[model samples]
Target: MQQLSWLPTHPDLSGAIGQAKRIEDPLQRLHEAVKLAAHQRDFTLTARLDKLAAAGIEQHAAAARLTPLRVALLSSHTVDHLLPAIRVAGLQRRLALSLHVAPYGMYRQALLADDPALNAFAPQLVVLALDAHDAPLQLPLQASQAEVDAAVAERVDELRLLWRRARERYAAQVVQQTLVPVAPPLFGSYEALVPASPRAVIERLNAAIRAAAREDGVLLLDLAWQAAAYGDGLAEPVRWHQAKQLVSPTLAPLYGEHLARIAAATAGLSRKCLVLDLDNTLWGGVIGDDGIDGIQLGQGSPS
Candidate 1:
């Protein structure tokens, strides 16, 4: 969506022109001058902000706060880069922060179970981190048309039995655990979040999820926006490369700022407790290979 228009121009047009002359790149100089004038609420300085916004250039300063609200952060990934921005934004909003890590599946299971402690926290929102590796399906299909036709004919004879069995199994599962409603549109659209999937099937599944959610009145927060903004598709190798580059000192701040914006967007939600895997996540070396003292955490040579 297009952002609002730029503010009014400043009284110091001559000074801005002088500064613009000093910049080497004519276009860049104009951009800088326009930005300076815009910040000063000068409309006559130019319509640069509107143009930049149209080009999808986000130039707002990092959000800052002195007294932040209480917020909880839940994620499986390291939050080193995200934390600073969140902290800055939270401070600006007067937010208090709490961080937690937990596996997505386990967290979902817990939420379904309606754990009192989880409910007691009464978070206004929750962020779920989903990875492509989580869902794997084994479908029944054949290469040849003859084989398919034969299989279909045989399955027709057993359709009644299959339906009964499927229904029974679904009912049993419902009795054992809560089933989150999943329907179409939103569910189908989410397939785009994956890198190597067939869009049609994903869309169908998404549609089903949306339908189910509508029927059950369950909220489904789509992270497609955030994923598209940060994810580098399903190529694991490429994602890893991008992640390394993102963590570099020069780039980390930009990532941090983006994270802060995300956190700010969901500021009211209380994050669940972080569940850590002790084996290799917390320490530099595996615990089995090295004693507790040998494991690198706070200091010493790299494990």
Candidate 2:
């Protein structure tokens, strides 16, 4: 397999950014600009780079042969800031992504055959991002377990239909996300045992998503797993509630990186082997002193 072209040995972020910005071709500009942004830790630069990358995708379309990835994003929330970062990260892994970010709140509409824009684009990869909070209805805690189950099932059925429609209308490889439930509800303990609570509904939806992914052979990105990893930092309440930003601006890179990793793996661009430091990683301690038996991390010992 061919190795990806990473950042040049020269560590000149500004110079590289300036050079990439000058390039006329958006995809080519993205190829260089994203790498520069990935190496920088500054949030300001990340935001700028994300915007730059997005502009690249928006200003021009890649020549079919030049782009290795033609990805159309169908998302519930505004992901204009997210798609560019994802494109650049994918480039790092050797996939030249040509990202078409569908308008926000088009997650359902894009899957339908009548949507001329989606039908016209017909991307090779379809990224379907949905949020449970965006659903039209929200049942209260007073609702019974049966009622909650029915509501959850209804949403699940809608999701499955969306996947099926996408499959039927296009040959694109589908990537869908498991919804991340918001923070603790105001009902608190009262909502804890209630199966119809917001949290419970989201959990049920996630389970259904997983099952559907298995049945439909769709690529599943676990946003719930990402949320757990980041703790409360996952969702920015102010931005989420006010602007409908599904993920916080501060943690957007993490989401971008996760998306890129999955896309790279799907595109056969990810690394094949993982070298582990056996002493600490593979085993609990050094084998020379622990003599294997003393070390934990075996079938008998606690992981």
Best by TM-score: 2
Each prediction's TM-score against the native? 0.34, 0.74
- Cα lDDT, model 2, residue 254: 63
* Candidate No. with top lDDT: 2
Give model 2's clash tally. Answer: 0
Give the alpha carbon lDDT tens digit for every residue of 30-65 in model 2.
656546654733334555565556655544434412
lDDT of each: 0.36, 0.69
Give per-residue lDDT, candidate 2, residue 50: 57
